[model samples]
Target: MTTTSPQIVASADGTPIAYESMGDGPPVILIGGAFNDRTTVAALAATLAPHVTAVVYDRRGRGDSGDNADTFAVEREIEDLAALIAAAGGRASLFGHSSGGILALEATAQGLPVERLAVYETPFVVDGLRPLPAEGTAEQIRAFVAKERRDEAVRLFLTEQVAVPAGMVDGMQASPAWPFLVGLAHTLPYDVAVCGADLALPADRLAKIGVPTLTMAGGASPAWFPAAAQAVAGAIPGASYLTVAGQDHGVLHNPDALREPLLTFLR
Candidate 1:
């Protein structure tokens, strides 16, 4: 499972979405969370490629994907996923992480032709384990990006929206990945929209999703993570729920632990 030639498809609004596909058999698209680009899930894509056709792509405002920022809408991103699905042979399974997970759920609810679906820590707030995102949080992120304070935008999203510890955020800034995350700061609002400002589990919308689904979280993550995953699973009838042992929000960087679990559900 190696990197393949990059591909691009025009979304409903004619925004070009760049993606790469590897392996064969049934197709499964991998959608990353906030600040992620296609490269963020490249390793996970590679791990799953041996079992299925794994497609990884840039969301609207990230990586090589073109964004219509003036007309940004969650529907546009759904349309983007629709185009990717069409390219994925009219229908495909989906595996989404964090905000991307929420996006996948929204797409399914909006009537996208997805097969089996899997989401990890969709980041919903349930039972008040974590407070809902404050109103105008997305606007604040947009304002930061507008002022070219990309680092501030990233920090705000991680600390306020994602609830990452300030110390951990500081550690991240010293890491090489911080720059890449900052480079995608403009998309933080898009992720916010994907999760919604309220951050409540969209139970009514999720009820519309009838496909076989899998919801998961890391055992080591904050209590809210599992609660959010469970709430999502409960909303989607018959959805399976599991907590990946010894894992946390950073599971994206450790694809191996997820390989078998995903392949089990995927196959």
Candidate 2:
């Protein structure tokens, strides 16, 4: 496995974001979804290293990154990506999964200098497939995190925000990954902030992103994912949509499934 020690970059807000780089080609930054840090995509980075300089980083407040602010905003996260791009020589392709996909799209909309962008199953609810969060859902999640009710925060996020079934949540809670989920539960509100309260596709904003873009979903992902991916792709002018066969939302867990398509698109 290719491995490298993490390096730090200061975001515009002065928060330190930790990232590690591997390989020797055009840079590609990997932005992980909720409950994920730099390590979550380390294997994918390693797999892509031979073709591109893959940089995987912890978003602020997770893993080795430092978060000093009392509040979370999507702008800060965007700035974090901006900093990573700067560290990657000022122009790089971005690959974001889930809420990370939302962040990448928002950053591009805000005029970040991205050469190319790829996103996997960003969870937008364009056709009312899932109801938008209640008006105060972000606040409620923040309160739960403030009270240190990590488990409750995790439960609320999985059940309400992500719409995972109750039985599946119960099963997940009993699994070994439950502890990791709880550990990162405080960032649930950040994820909510990235997706926004509306949970609808920001067609106008997404339409403004003027980069080569690829939006993708897993063939076996939940019913809502393909629609969400398609909606996002359709909203963005010139964006292409793809479905990775025999995969689901956890497709990142199997890096090989993503290797060829990403290489082809990114190259």
1-267: candidate 1 lDDT, tens digit per residue: 224557999998888999999887899999998988898899998888888999999999787889865844789889999999999999999999999999999999888999999999999989999766567878888899999999999998988898878999999999998888889888888898888888888899899998999999999999999999999999898899999999998899999989999999988
lDDT of 2 at 128: 80
Candidate 2 TM-score to native: 0.97
The residue-by-residue lDDT of candidate 2 on 1-267, one tens digit each, is: 224567999999899999999899999999999999988998999889999999999999998799876688898999999999999999999999999999999999999999999999999986788766666777778889999999998988888788888899999999999999999998888899999876878999999999999999999998789999999999999999999999999988999999999999999
lDDT, each prediction = 0.90, 0.91
- How far is 23's C-alpha from truth in model 1 (Å)? 0.6
Give TM-scores for every candidate, taking all chains together and pairing residue i with residue i.
0.96, 0.97
Q: Which regions in candidate 1 have their CA more than 4 angstroms from the true location?
A: 1-5
Steric clash pairs (candidate 1): none
